[model samples]
Target chain A: MRPGRRIAGWVFIAPALIVIGVFFLLPVLLAVGLSLTDFDIYALASLRNLQFVGLDNYLAVLRMGLFWRALGNTLYFVVVGVPLSIGAALGAALLVHSRLARCRGFFRVALFTPVVTNLIAVAVIWKYLFQTRYGIVNFVLGRFGVHPVDWLGDPHMAMPTIILFALWKNFGYAMIIVLAGLQAIPDELYEAARLDGASAWRQLRHITLPLLGPTLMTVGLLTMVGYFQLFAEPYVMTEGGPLQSTLSVLYLMYNQGFDWWNLGLASAIAFVLFVFTLAATGLLVRAGRRKGWV
Target chain B: MNRARAAAWTVNGLLAVLALVTLFPLLWMLSVSLMPQGSASTFPPPLLPAHPTLANYRTLFVAADLGRYLLNSLIVSGGITLGALVCNLLAGYAFAKLRFAGRDRVFGLLLAALVIPSQVAMMPLFLLVRELHIVDSYAGVILPALASIFGIYLVRQYARAIPDEMLEAARIDGAGELRIFLRVVLPLLKPIILTLTILTFLTAWNDFMWPLIVLTGNHHFTLPIALASLAREHNPDVEMLMAGSVVTVVPVLLLFLLLQRYYIQGLLLGSVKR
Candidate 1:
């Protein structure tokens, strides 16, 4: 690696670096700058409206009623959806990794199928499936003599329905990762546990779960990062409707940026979301390291 | 032995049933797509269509605007796949084996940046694209993804496996840097390129949020967008929606089926952090 060859290396990689810098890195930095000032469509007409407001946009977004509502909805989604996602993934992994699971290839493919499907298409199908009047979900409820409830049209039900969709769409990803983890565990440990008169559940708690900590941690972090970016579900199935109950932070940023053309406020919201993800990821890494898991 | 065998059998039985549960909605989607109008919602939830028909497909092609959406998806996905492959491969090779200034620091920065969500860039990026006057164009959607950090990272990881002596010998033969890259490196990197190709294609093909915001006109909508629009337009037409779903999923599904070995291998390689 000579000094002149060093120049060649940079030249070879320069195009990608430049593009990402312009589109990705520069935008991130610009977003921070935009958040500090008052920029909007009005500002676009003449640069006069763009004044340095110095945290004014963040203060404004924080004080706005809709912003709080969106944050609450996003938190509700992450709190509920994250656990459901992990739980389903764990369950599916257990079933598939079990000794009795014959034709394992077929089962793995079947479980992973939903993950690769288009979210928009599936969310569309799910919306109709849960429709209040003629939906098969309500129809099945009718058979059980339970009253029909509007799943997407009701604000309370809308977020829950979206969470369910998220869980279904995503759980398989973690399932595969965990299954791979399970497969990596040595069989001798389980055999020894069995010989020691440990029950199936006990063996699982002591051996299987402890070994799976790293995989689950990875799954958890990825799921949290993904859940924080909840937009497409609300956009498709609920449209952040029924009193804006399903409006995630990303969704809020979008509506503000594109719909209202309030770039400053939207950029603030984007920065806030990024900070939240950073904090959450940091906490996850710390916890993993503390537990000697990472 | 007998007791353990029975338990394993029971476990296998449960898994088979669970697998069926997982696949039911997709299979039902297909069945409903083929069912005659007003035929999918009967009691007992028709396991199979009484009489399968291609009317829904015909309706999608002729009545709905899905064909245009499909074309839009093709252009967007194809452009990103081809463009990103070139950028990522060149950068990856440079990062892996070539001598570069600030190489380690730059690669490390890219790795660290992976933790940051891309949505953070969206607000300003939209404004940037709008300024460029490429807003709502295929280029606007395609350009951002043309150089993916993850793709470069994946290729770098694979490229490291190429023995250094091979490159050294090429250098000893007085081959130029790009010549060594084209002749010696790329041929060894074929399998990974194919894997990355499928991965990038699927990712670009399935993108929803960005396109949803950028492409405002129906003429520029992708298949997912069109399906979503049609679902909103004709909510009562379950069969029609199913037909749209079939259109949206079948090509990627076929591609996956054909190249599953590589797909799974790519997944393992891309996901597992070293």
Candidate 2:
């Protein structure tokens, strides 16, 4: 309201505005410019070598077969991992939210423990645990007359193994959110359902799931966006291999950018990933609106 | 009555099994870390060490120089947390309480920019840092993370509940805005402050990709980056690797356990409140 207060407001926000503008907003704009040029190791050695090639970087990215494979790998991960993760979270939420469940606090903390641990640390633990010969997973299966499966070493099994690891590492986050949503539902609805001689299945089908539509949609959107950025798991556990089966879009970008110093190509790849993420978010939001959930 | 009792038992039994499955890997990580070197590489790998020893931990600190990386992690994460708190708190409060021209429009622009992933900015940000001559230094890792959009949004949501009447009274007494903020607003924001501190510390400590790219030298490597490089090395020493994992994971894990109430509360506030 006062002139002094108005000046004070500007001073208060100045530090944050400077940092975001210089570091985040500026780089985003620069990335677009960087993508238009052939900025590689030669350019890194000398700025004079940088050549503005227009859309050449984007065109090269689209024409590369490895880029297609990486895109396909990322899509497969999201398509498979999103539902599995949500299903696990919802199941765990229902169990923990049950009136009859005991030690609810213990179960909640135990389930959430994985979410807090460092991703690199836990991925190391998983890589050792799924080792073909000496891993506990294979050893346990061997006793049941099942042969030891090369979980990380096989081309076909690497992505699935990485998906399982992602599911385990992440389900706790959505579980906590879903639990909050579950708590918000009034008990009166279930009580009313019971008065009509409803079965447990019928009560869930008719009431709980419907009421939870928006929460599930939110969880699905967040989980899908996260899953599409699958880099660390493959980087640590499989190194994008047995046959590049687990190579994600982000991993491909990392290799192109850092490993080879192909900055322009990497910038193009980054925009491609952003475009996919935006498309997915737009689609989800539209679906939510159509269903009147948002 | 008997049917109700049976259902309760069934539910609890199922929960116990699920908890065990969920906790086993982490428990095994701790277990394998303590095993004698090479003992864990045998058939049907042992769940617990036969003769538990600190040999692996000793190697990590002594041979691998993990203590230096541990110290690096503390410095980087702590720096980012403090800096981000100051910046986000000031801006968030301004957005919620202060009046400025085009304030809402600027806030709208920041919110829209949230969709662009951090990776999109990494290459140019790297070059920018290189130009500033801060690359391969702690400042390189700490500068870009000095503020975040989510942090400001969190603080704004919490600070909105502070009553305007109290601020008006302070202004009437000739208290400057800074004095009023320091004296009145901060104490009321204690809960969100705690939530934001824990959230920022954990995220900074666990961040891998950014630190890996920026901090190129081994001396500047944070715990996660150091552990990743070590794992990728041609080392088959499983026990030692597990020990490294333990060292990397335990601090944040313990912090989460101690302040889980605040942590979970923040999680709900961040996700569901919107």
Candidate 3:
């Protein structure tokens, strides 16, 4: 309560408060205002051209087919990608956490390498690996008598390919978290189960799953939130191409806001994405609570 | 016992295969970068180069001008790391140690704001930068990074563990708050500061969307932005693109390899506490 301490507190926190206030928080508030106006390149040239359109931008974005298509693409990504990643993470965690497993350190690093690698760079590598004719993915598939599927070049396949790439890159991160959760489970539970003649599968199904509920919920929510903002992968890999199947909501916002400079429409798309994110997160939390995991 | 041994073999075998699958793309990237020009586009898709060379790397630097982008990335990321460290440390320490009104309320606001994805503010943030005439400049890319809610939270969590009595001892010895922070608290927070530095650097270096939006010309491009633009121009040149990937990924990959403990700890500390 001393004046000196209070003043020091204010001084220490001022720089961060100012920067975040002016850049992050202020922009968020301004975005809502910007969304309600017809702000475009013309407005950029002259502020007098900026017109207050109220909720028209939001209505226009709602009616726009591209916006809906982008939303669908994003939803398709989250719906499929979240489960694929969690499954892979759970499997990898179980494997690495297995008593029979060896070289735990090596395996962990190798798996996690992808998560830390440059997105645009790895995306480029993936583009090559899935490059139809000369691509290694198709080349390997041919050995199995499976024909070369156009991974990124086909509309239906593009989103799936992106999903595959995402799962591969991201699962390790979740796996590491799950592995931590796995380790936290006391050894006596397994020992007790073993003495009772319960199988490893039974132990995992009953004990591991029940205990890992909270961790899995958190992982699932984080993965869903992250996947909803898919941008860089498709930006570098497909450019939302092959009939725009890989175009995400964030990608749409990027194109509208940056590429086209339609700040109003772009802000509306951003908010729409925000709403979906909130709704999905809320649903997950509710589901978690209903299951008594939270 | 035989069945148990067999199960162990199966688990290890699957793990080996999984590790291989995970690392195959990155390994192939290194190999293709060494392959002779146009060799990676072969029928079997050669795993390694017949006559290994640095020609692709040479072309990346000399012909593609990746060196400039690399320097730009270093400057921008370094600037951000240093600036963010100072700001976050001061604020985080203040939130943890100093007495102030509305401190908890403001911190709670920041925690809530974390749910608002950064992309939601990108449109107006970009416009704001333009109004400030920072667009197409490195300042635009580096300035926003000076304020990070997550960074502040991370530092605060670590700072709270610095026993208050140590700070009190320093204060009683006629050391001012700023002096105590620099002379007394900083030494205790070295590990965390390093972790923050690495995280901020990696995030800034690998950052794509913001840089791509802000940096218009090739002159100001970071590695990721430069590589993305280069991919568009040289999509068919598989070997060349791999070389670009290597150039873009190698620095961060090396950094992670060197500081794996700090990086992973930062990740776990940030996530598990949630």
Q: Could you give the interface RMSD of each candidate, to one decimal?
A: 2.0, 0.9, 1.0
Q: Alpha-carbon error at B171 in model 3, in Å?
A: 1.5
lDDT per model vs. reference = 0.85, 0.92, 0.90
**How close is candidate 2 at the interface, in terms of C-alpha RMSD after superposing the true interface residues?**
0.9
- Which docking category, incorrect, acceptable, medium or high, applies to candidate 1? medium
Please list the residue runs of candidate 1 whose C-alpha ends up more than 4 Å from where it truly belongs after superposition. Answer: A1-4, B1-6, B38-47, B234-236
TM-score of chain B of each: 0.95, 0.97, 0.97
Query: Evaluated with DockQ, which candidate comes out highest?
Result: 2
lDDT of 2 at B269: 79
Q: Candidate 3: lDDT over CA atoms?
A: 0.90
State in Å the error of residue B28, model 2. 0.7
lDDT of 1 by residue, A63-179 (tens): 889988888898899889997999889988998888777778888888888888888878877886787876777878889998888999988899998998888788888888888
The TM-score measured for candidate 1 stands at 0.94
Rank by DockQ (best first): 2, 3, 1
- What TM-score goes with each of the models? 0.94, 0.98, 0.98
Docking quality tier of model 2: high
RMSD for each of the candidates? 2.2, 1.2, 1.2
Ranking 1 against 3 by lDDT, winner: 3
